[model samples]
Target: MRVKRYVVNALPEAVSMIRSELGKDAVILNTKEIRVGGFMGMFSKKKMEVIAAIESNQANTPAQPQRKASPQANEALEQILHTVQRTASAVMEPPIVTPAEKQTGRVEQEQSIIDEIRDLRQYMVKLSKQQGDHTALSEQLYELKEHLLEQEVEMQWVERLIQAIIDKQTEQKSEFTKEQIWQLAAEQLEDWLRPYGGIGISSAVRVVHFVGPTGVGKTTTIAKLAAEQTIKQGRKVGFITSDTYRIAAVDQLRTYANILNVPLEVVFSPMDLPRAFKQLEERELIYMDTAGRNFRSELHVSEVNSLLHTSEDSETVLVLSLTGKTKDMAAVADHFSKYGVRKVLFTKLDETSVYGAIFNLIMNFEMYPTYLASGQTVPDDIDRFQIETYIQHLLGSSSR
Candidate 1:
């Protein structure tokens, strides 16, 4: 390997010099800025220094016997000697080239070799123009290479199923219509959610309650849903609070009610819950906010169960924080399962950088997310659950 060092005011200039002298095969070993003198460095400007190395094809060739110097050859040698002396005076080492293996006397062959070298240099120049290695180009090349090798391997059964669908379409001599495609997709989705039973839009003015461990944003999520249904869709919405254990919880729900102009009822016990529901019986949709409690505490769990048992017709939704770890999320899910949770609502999606826990929880607990609350903004930061959008967002797709 032939190693060389170059000093310049700019990185681009240093790289240009390395490419010009050592070609594209040169590898940059290191780069830094250093002062020329020690005590006088205060007055000296910093110079960019780059060390690059290139492999030489002729370095291992055996030396040839020296030929008698001609008048023209002596003049050429003297010029080369002067250039070497000048380079040595400026830097630590001068550039070195290996001697040719044979001392051929034929002038025609030497001219032919020089012509071939010029052709090779032109070819290299064309290659460099066709493929420039700028910072952005290197980054894009890395990303493409990683994506090609990092693709997931699906099951053989899934591939067979896709082939079967294609075969059936071809045999029937029919193209899939939008409705047929939608039906097929819905059927496949329904199969995945078969364990959770079918989802139906409630026609009986059913109450959907949010319950979960502390700091999961139950009250905020309730406010989001109420605003979406009442303000956006013009549904008759009612708010009920069974979170009376904490005065702050009751105040939070009341604040949302005052803003949304919806009636808010506070239920202290299971007996009070029935009366609270009666007040909102005529409303099209009712949302109940429960106190955020520690799932590990048996007393808190019992208290929540007492409130939930009072209303057998209401659907209970578990609100989980996407920022929680996978194990903690699974434990929380198991603890809340005792309350007969019908669906899950994930909160703090914007606060978490890694969303692997969301997939782990859903696949492990066999539950589908009903909604996702991304930020703390009231009504605007929440979005209905869409698997494709969520997946694309978590996978770092800019279009999402």
Candidate 2:
């Protein structure tokens, strides 16, 4: 392999340079943001460090007629396919044993390889899809890819989903309709998201703190959950709000409390949590709503973490919205994750047709999604995270 590194302001620039210098067979092995040429940890330039490589023989071979696909895409696809093929070959094939070798040893060795290959095959499928080309996908696959991209799914994931479907088509060697293509995509998505599903607020927990950025419906979500517990389950529920900064925040929550006949407490700071908890001690469940700040900042996340201090069994649920930018939500989730926030609740589902942000956040952070709130209706619109339902929302009604 011929490997080369390039540092450029963005990925597109790096791709242009790689295609011109390394030929159309090169693929990007890795890329990351890096800072260069700054003094005293200040004024550093942010640039992308891209590592690309091509097979030695491919490098030496004469250029062939270019296809319709862009050189940059072809180059990327070639390198990725090369790496996957090499890795899969290495894993799928075991070392040869001599015929004269011990029969007992040979049997054991073959059995071990068989078991390993079974597991490795599944992993290899994922790796293949993750690194495969997207340019030459079939008509059905291309349509599915375009729909997912329109839904705001990340590019890497889109490639993986399409590649998996392509692999299936190749294996079956049959034509597929748009509906069939979408079914394959849904299956792949479910397989990837299965491990992160079926978890929500624990009934055994005494306190559930809701935290996130401003205007993500944290206050209303709290009310919804409180109503669910109070009216549906007949569990005594109470509300605590440190969201004094938002005008009418207390009143909005108090209105829900009055409807449910649940007690409410107001805490301005971390020091007042003990008194607030004492006031709501009779309640079976307490849903504390924290003041939503710029949680993308580590300092703000820490401030919320301080308020989360308690001896009672508790869990912090990060509230996010589908309306927010994927990158910005990722920033907030990243910061909160550092403080050990593992559970997430997404709101405003009805407001946005784009549901890929939910998938992106859950997959990227390994955060367990508890609930999805679609509308303003208390407890009615919010439902426990279901993989089938979510995939339906994500894939929509038509594959075309």
Candidate 3:
């Protein structure tokens, strides 16, 4: 090992010098802050004294004999190392442009990014009166954040909600009241729930297909929708099933179809879809039930995609159970999203208390939900998706 001492203006300069000379394999042995260029202590300049060393490669690999490199290989390696060193040095030194302006702009951009991070951190930490003038608003926001978290809402979602509230508060400088805060929060949910979020009956949408993981109650949800449109709205509805994977599932759907008194078409392959469509051409709404498959399997997803050929005529609804983990639900949504899943339907709402996953899915996928199925009863268990209903469920408050 060889050790050398370096005196430089800063530790980084010393480190760069040591690395440039002995390479990154050099180890820092010791360092000390020192004074230099001074006749008296008053005029002294601060500097760093560094001692570094590197062991010979052969010393570390003593057990193995060193293999001799061919002359051509050694020359190539040396050339490569030289190029790398040149590139690294060039990157370390900035180009000679409008240096001062460039540095100033870069610093401002960095500071802006830092300020944004601080604001986000502020969202998590309750602000004190010593911090700023918005003490009252800060307390309200802090309380709002705690309430959402107590309901098992995700931290990022809560932060986003708080950030949005802060933005609105900046614009409207009104006396903040407890009722006003609650009213503002509810109104914000309205904006989050707009644009394609409304649930209704329409003649424009022809083929509505439901797909999801196993035991999410997709068939039952379909039965509920069909019964509403046929019996209540007096619209002509039809049923189609590609769920031939089990005889029991087909029979269950057939029972619903028999009770509803609607024609049911069973298609074993993708080619049979158009034939089914032809059979029910005069129907106003055709609800297609897909076989429940493990969405994690690529083969199964592809098979569903092939059968769903999902055109403008089709509106596919991916059904998910609220009892599932958010990550798994996200994965199931992402996997099936490729097959043109325009809307979602959540089942088993009664099984879980936390409903943040519902909102998270809406924001993450930008796909709004159509219905929420809370129980086993057909036509009675499913309700249209409404933000107020979800907000009530999330807060554990009964709808008024």
lDDT of 2 at 246: 85
Clash count list over all predictions: 0, 0, 0
Model 3 regions more than 4 Å off = 1-140, 150-152, 167-178, 199-202, 310-312, 396-400
Per-residue CA lDDT of model 2 for 1-400, tens digit only, reads 9999999876567766876777666766755567899899899987767788888876755443332566775576556444443443443354676777645576676566545544543453343333334434666676778888998889999988877887887799976887888887888999999999998888889999999999999989998888888788899888899999889999999998898888999998888999999998898899999998998789988988899989989999999999999889999999999889999999999898999888888888899999999888987989999999999999988732
Model 1 poorest ten-residue lDDT run: 148-157
Instruction: Indicate whether candidate 1 or candidate 2 has the larger TM-score.
Output: 2
User: Which segments of model 2 are wrong by more than 4 Å?
Assistant: 1-135
Clash pairs, candidate 1, are none
Instruction: Give the C-alpha lDDT of model 2.
Output: 0.81
**lDDT minimum window of 10 residues, candidate 3:** 124-133
Using alpha carbons, what is the TM-score of model 2?
0.68
What lDDT would each prediction earn against the true structure?
Answer: 0.63, 0.81, 0.72
Q: Is candidate 1 or candidate 3 better by lDDT?
A: 3
Q: Write the per-residue lDDT of candidate 1 for residues 37-152, one digit (tens) a residue.
A: 54655677667677877778723343222233357744753454344333323332223433452344334444554454345444444544334432212233334223322322
